[model samples]
Target: MKLHTPKTLPYIPVAPGALPILGHFAKMKNNQVAFLEETQKKLGPLFWLNAGFGQWTVVVTGEAAHTVMKNKETRSDVMGGEGDRITGHITTDTVSIKDGAPHRRIRGAIQSPFTPKGLTVSEIGALLEETAEKRTSGWKENTKLEILHETSVYALDIIFRMLGVADLDLPLWRKTYNDFVGPWTMIPFNFPGSPRWRSLKARDWMDKEFQKMIDQARATGDTKTMLGAIVHGTDEEGQGLEPKELFANLRILGLAGHETTAATVAWMFIHMGATPELWEEIREEAVAADSPPTSPKDMERFPKIEALFREVLRLYPVINVLTPRRVEEPIEIYGVKIPKDTSVSASLLSLSRDANLYPNPETLSLERWTKQAHRPKPSEAVQFGGGPHFCLGYHLAVFEGVVYTTIAARRLASLGLQPVLQGEIPKPTYMPLTRPPAEAKILLKPNYKA
Candidate 1:
């Protein structure tokens, strides 16, 4: 493999502070976004900052972001090296950190479960109904609830069942998974028996469980479900995936399928709750459609509802920062040549909020999407990311989003439910790192019955 060498680019300097050894570690340890924004204000979009030691991080936005995310030459090297420091905390051999042919093979193996052709439409509809029923039971009249945790549980349960991990230990898995993966976003250290340590343990447990599942499936001679497919799948050489690779890929698909979708669903409720008029409009639109609440085809036709979702992702993307990319070859970005081995990131938070791409970017407008809805192709929104590394489970995420939103909107419309926002939803403190607040609450009141 040809390695690109580092070349000096026009330097956009961040604020000069911190001791030589500490760098900006203190500020970053406290609040990453505040640190980034402070630097951006001081240094501009292409600024460089010292993360620690001699390590430097280049933060890019707007067109620069579009370039970084789509730059095939850069490869997803950061995910390979450092991502394991995070993802490995949850599960090992995750596809996110795998490269080249290995990545392709793992993703291909699991693709069937999420694709439209994979599951029968009737099966999907039934799953959605089961999920909605499970979710709606917790919602009370004029109640205040945190949607993220609820949606996460619903999504996890659905994914777990779909993957055929029905009898696995739930509480132990949840605690271990969260403990290991969650902290990695905030800090990279892994002390023994710590959350990271426990995460490792959980991962090992999952690995054994996955192997047992595969073994049982092999014994039964079934390749119908996702777990069975992975176990029974063969490469061009006609060899099945090794135990480690199978476990890793399964963990990656399972966790990625749930976490990001749950976060986006949380953001959806927060957005809808904050905007009463838009919420009511969506409610009315869903009620007017009068189709089965969980039908994907009918959900696809609800432009306003779709627009509302698009706008929410625009304002508050779930994965705020694109995982780091390493330059594989020399590339010019905004007239500066970035050499190989340079660590770079695209801020989806900054890109989605760009005023040029999104006029009056701070204000939420559902119609903005509706007016441009006729355009053929994906929107500029990088919430699902772009290029080869784009989310494999994109359709599944959208399916859940549509189903959950449709159910909420229809219920609210029928009872004329109005959500009373208490205060501003908390911004992510760790840039793209943190999850929705555990205590964040929204109150709902039913007014006019449809």
Candidate 2:
């Protein structure tokens, strides 16, 4: 494959804090958000920062960020060579990361479960409410819990059930999956029992397990679960998922489907806990009250609940940076040429915080979304990357968040309760996905009925 384009156009401005082989590593590791924010203030939207080992990371802010995300010449299929190498190319064919025709085919074949028809099924809605109720069922005064950890359990349960894999060992599944995804494995080493070695081993084990599910579904013609849908569904051209494609995509889909939603819900808890009065207002709008959602249409029935999730997603996007996009051939954005095989990404956080896109960007206001009765198209969704590669699971994620929040709020309201968060407001994790800090805790406080 061609690795570079002819140097016919002037290069994008390069940020200047290189320190030999270390590059910008010192400034970026711990203080990335502050570093990027300050750089964007001075560098104006788009610039390249050296990331050592001959790599240049393209960082774009504001409108140019959206341009890169939507540009057809830019490919989201590649992150870096090492991201896929350790897991035997586990994500090489994932629908969310593939480009062009392959992406279209896999996305079409596997998206049955995320569509309105798929989610509108009465059982699916009931399942979400049941799961939400399960998560909030045991909370009591003085309860000590990490919000992120709690939401993660809820999200994983939902995605696994949807995939018909709930019978598997979920805690073990997440741990193994985490091993495969941990950043430390990016070291490119594969010694036995090392993180990279364990990641590869986990992928192999997970693949065998998924293949068995696929085999059973195809034999029985099972069509109830999301896994079954992918097995039976076809693309517009009547193409079906190849085995490796199915395995790879299922793995990424499970991770993407649950983890991001979990992180977003954790933020929802933090915000809602801080504002007890808002919970009363939100609970009043939850027509379901003490029960789970009754039907697929119930997804849209709770306006305040939906807006609460929307505002939380906007203020604290779980995926701050869209996964790396690889430039294909030559592409120009804001008059700067990005050559073939160049890796870049857009900052969802920056775009979400842009004053032009969101007024009072730092403040939380349900009015920003509720007044407009906003349901954003994927192409314009700021928190979820906008464009062809926009998150395919947006509806499912939102449904899960809305259902959980509504149930939790309504359940608390029924008991004359509100969550009073303990400890200082938690800060975002220093990781790429901005989950609420694991130590942040919440406890019950009394508030009158909805």
Candidate 3:
């Protein structure tokens, strides 16, 4: 689709820096959020930036961000072409790289298990209980534990059960999955026998494992699980998904599901530890609700807990950048015209913390969401994104967040955990990525119920 170029020209110039060849790569690499914020401050809401070669990326604001995410004409090109160039290196079927009909078809097939309404709460509660028991089972008094590692493992287990792959060796699977996804966020260089290479090896292993499960499900006539649903599901043409497509869907589901949720949950715990007042409030709510400890249905009553999760997401979104899209037609956003085929991305991390939208954006206030008088509409927060490509797993993510946070809050309150105030948690070594701290520790003592 060719975009109409206006005679008056709407293209906004990016703030100038760097030599001809280097461009803004250095600034982006050093600290992506700060660099972008600095650029936005100087260049205004929508500005362009050189990101290698002749490619220019348009960084947009929150208002324009809503439009960009909802613009159907501006196709999600990242799922194909350039998206594939990067994601395909790790797994050939990475769902983020698939576009158009294929993307829709695959998403439909995989969404079957999630169709069982109200299952998320129950499932997540079960998983959280299992994780809590396992984590505290080995805890010794005064011993420091890395919550990030523990939570990462817990998140993976939850995802595995949700995907109907619970029987696999978790430690080995965790190691392999981490190795596979770890390098994808880094610069697109692959070294011989490096971590990236090992990740590729892991991807191959995962592909085979998924394929084996698919074959087993088909042979055994098991259509009860998500994996089975995908394997057995037929398209409009009444044909089952090809092995490659099935593997691609599973690859994306497995990788995306575990990593993002794990990071967010770990961050949530860290924030709770830092702010004990919020933690106590959550514990009191959960206890006063008098709801069955393990019941998912009862947990939904705690909107404060849910709000706390949203606050954390606002501060540290798991996927800091929105999925990139290419303009198919000339579109004006915040008075700036973007030409056809221009690449653009919404800075979700920046937007969520925009002082204009969120007052006192840096503070961790769980009640911010409860103050309906000050709350923005649901669409204001793009944590799960907007429009057609919005996260299919959003409800599931929220359910898990509520379950894990509620359980953790209750347990911590009961134990009278006194969090150590430290500097900011470890930032990702790679830009625009979510990596947990090297060691995330919290202290616990007996609670004096007030």
Number of colliding residue pairs in each model: 0, 0, 1
lDDT tens per residue, model 3, 1-450: 222221223456565674465566666655555666677878788777655433456767766787777756576754444345445554455445556676666666666555425354234456556665665555443545576776677777776665566545777777777787774433455678776677778878988877777778889887665566667876565656667777766767766666677677777767756666766677777666554235434545777887887887787776666756787777888866677777777777667888897899988776677876653444755877877667766666666667676666555555555344255655542233544554666655444343
TM-scores across all candidates?
0.84, 0.89, 0.84
Off by over 4 Å in 2: 1-31, 50-55, 80-88, 287-291, 294-296, 448-450
User: What value does the lDDT take at residue 274 in candidate 2?
Assistant: 82
Candidate closest to the true structure, highest lDDT: 2
- Tens digits of lDDT, candidate 1, 1-450: 222212254454554565575566666556555566566667677766555544455767667787777757676656433344434344346666556787677666666655655554326656766667667755656878777777777677767666676635555556655654564433455678566666667677777777787789889987777667667776554656667777767776656777777777777787777776767787777777765345444455677776776777777676666777778777777777677777777877777777887899888888787787363134455877776677777666776777777777666655556665568976643323434665566777775443
Worst 10 residues of 1 by lDDT: 1-10
* lDDT at residue 94 of model 1 (Cα atoms): 62
Model 2 scores worst on lDDT over the 10 consecutive residues at 1-10
For candidate 1, what is the TM-score?
A: 0.84
Candidate rank order under lDDT: 2, 1, 3
Candidate 2 C-alpha error for residue 358, in Å: 1.2
Which portions of model 3 miss their true places by more than 4 Å? 1-11, 15-30, 50-55, 79-84, 91-94, 115-124, 166-168, 184-192, 234-240, 289-298, 373-381, 414-416, 421-430, 445-450
Residue 85 of candidate 1: its Cα lDDT? 44
Query: Alpha carbon lDDT of residue 183, candidate 2?
Result: 61
Q: Tell how far residue 200 is off in model 2, in angstroms.
A: 1.4
Better of 1 and 2 by lDDT: 2
